[model samples]
Target: MNDEKISVDNRDYVGALASGLEVLSAFDVQHKKMTLSEVAQITGMDRAKARRLLLTLHALGYIAKDGREFRLTPKVLRLGYAFNASNDHLDVVQHYLQSVTSELGESCSLSILDNDEIIYLVRSSAAHRLMSINITPGTRLPAAYTSMGRVLLAQLSAAEQKDWLARAQLLEHTDNSIVDKNRFVNMLKDVKQQGFCVVDQELELGLRSIAVPVFDYQGKLLGAANISTNSLRVSMQSLIDKYLPALQDAAKSITAHAK
Candidate 1:
């Protein structure tokens, strides 16, 4: 079977269009306001190239300047707006995620698998912070390391999962992080069997999470939803014994009646 992607663009596949988007992506939450040198450093481009792109973006009103630094303008939001608007159920999902945060007093999020990574789309955080970096919409984490990611990954067929494991470089993010491919595969099987997963400080120190997959009314997989809390504040047993049940119940309620 042919697996190669067919090009629909008449222009060169590798061109200015790609570079401009790459430049935009390089300016994330941590590096939002950046100088030309910062943009070049983030994007791995020369200063001249980064400057040209930044200047072009600034001229187009997609970016604004303050002295020597550039930051994305409201126009950048239009891109996110388009995505939000197109996804019909995102707001509904986001509302429920917020409700979970309110009920559990923990951070809850809905994320979908994107190119082998779990990209959070809806995030409802409790008043308290959980990590050095604040959790927000569009945050991405390694799929193999997150409870949400693992539950979503469990939805993949056996063959697809095998291919992913073969290609994935399972890095140990922490001492507790699962680095062995065999152990990872077994964990996925357990997730599939149990219909939920509780990861206790596996991805990061002092952070624990439990996740369950979400499905539509017709039983189509939507994504996975998770509630994360601090380990010191929430015990490991509570995460597995209590948090997992809460998340699964929320997930079932949403799927069965959230519409």
Candidate 2:
């Protein structure tokens, strides 16, 4: 039933397959492209094993080799696509996200908490760029410093939050980032009480975002919906006064139709 039990009951589980998946996941935002030895180091696998896995993935079209580096290919998108195909609610969420973007002329997104990161499931981008990094579906950001991340984190119970923070190392990405675990916990408590979260240039300079939790008709948590804008173009008061309501309304609309 628990993760430990599942790990122990690995009679049907294929360790090699799991290691191959680990090699795939090791290629993240920071490690976008890596050499064979780098891959082996990250995955803690022998060089020969890593080389075999990388070649198999490359042959399967999931990865592409560029000079000495190997990066995930467009074919890798099929994995994320499979998730979208399985989740009908993502389509409904996307519709409302488009509506939000149309009304506010800003980027809107829906993201779910995945461990210490928030994975964007749906995004409707405005014409202007909001962050130095491109925002898109499947983008992952640190959950400790993102508006949607906090909103999703607020949904967790206190003990769960503590357990997560025990393992999470809050590296300071910016001076505005909450690096102290206790302070971040307090911030989540505030988000829980308010039913929303506003992060102001904490994750990235000049980037501000506000988010509200999304739920199904039966009140099951779906995800968090957020509006991302440039801090220079939008003030904190404006975000709370203008974008927050729109984000909350969109979340409500998505919840209504999600079921």
The most accurate candidate by lDDT is 2
**In model 1, what is the error at residue 103, expressed in angstroms?**
2.7
Candidate 1 has an lDDT of 0.85
TM-score of 2: 0.91
Query: Which TM-score value belongs to model 1?
Result: 0.84
Candidate 2 error regions (>4 Å): 1-5, 29-32
Candidate 2 colliding pairs:
none
Q: For candidate 1, lDDT tens digit of each residue in 137-206? A: 8887888889999999899999989999888988877899998999999999999999998887777899
Task: List TM-scores for all candidates, in order.
Answer: 0.84, 0.91
lDDT of candidate 2 over 61-118, digit per residue (tens): 9999999999998888888889989899988999999999999899999999999999
Error of 2 at 248 (Å): 0.9
Off by over 4 Å in 1: 1-15, 46-49, 257-259
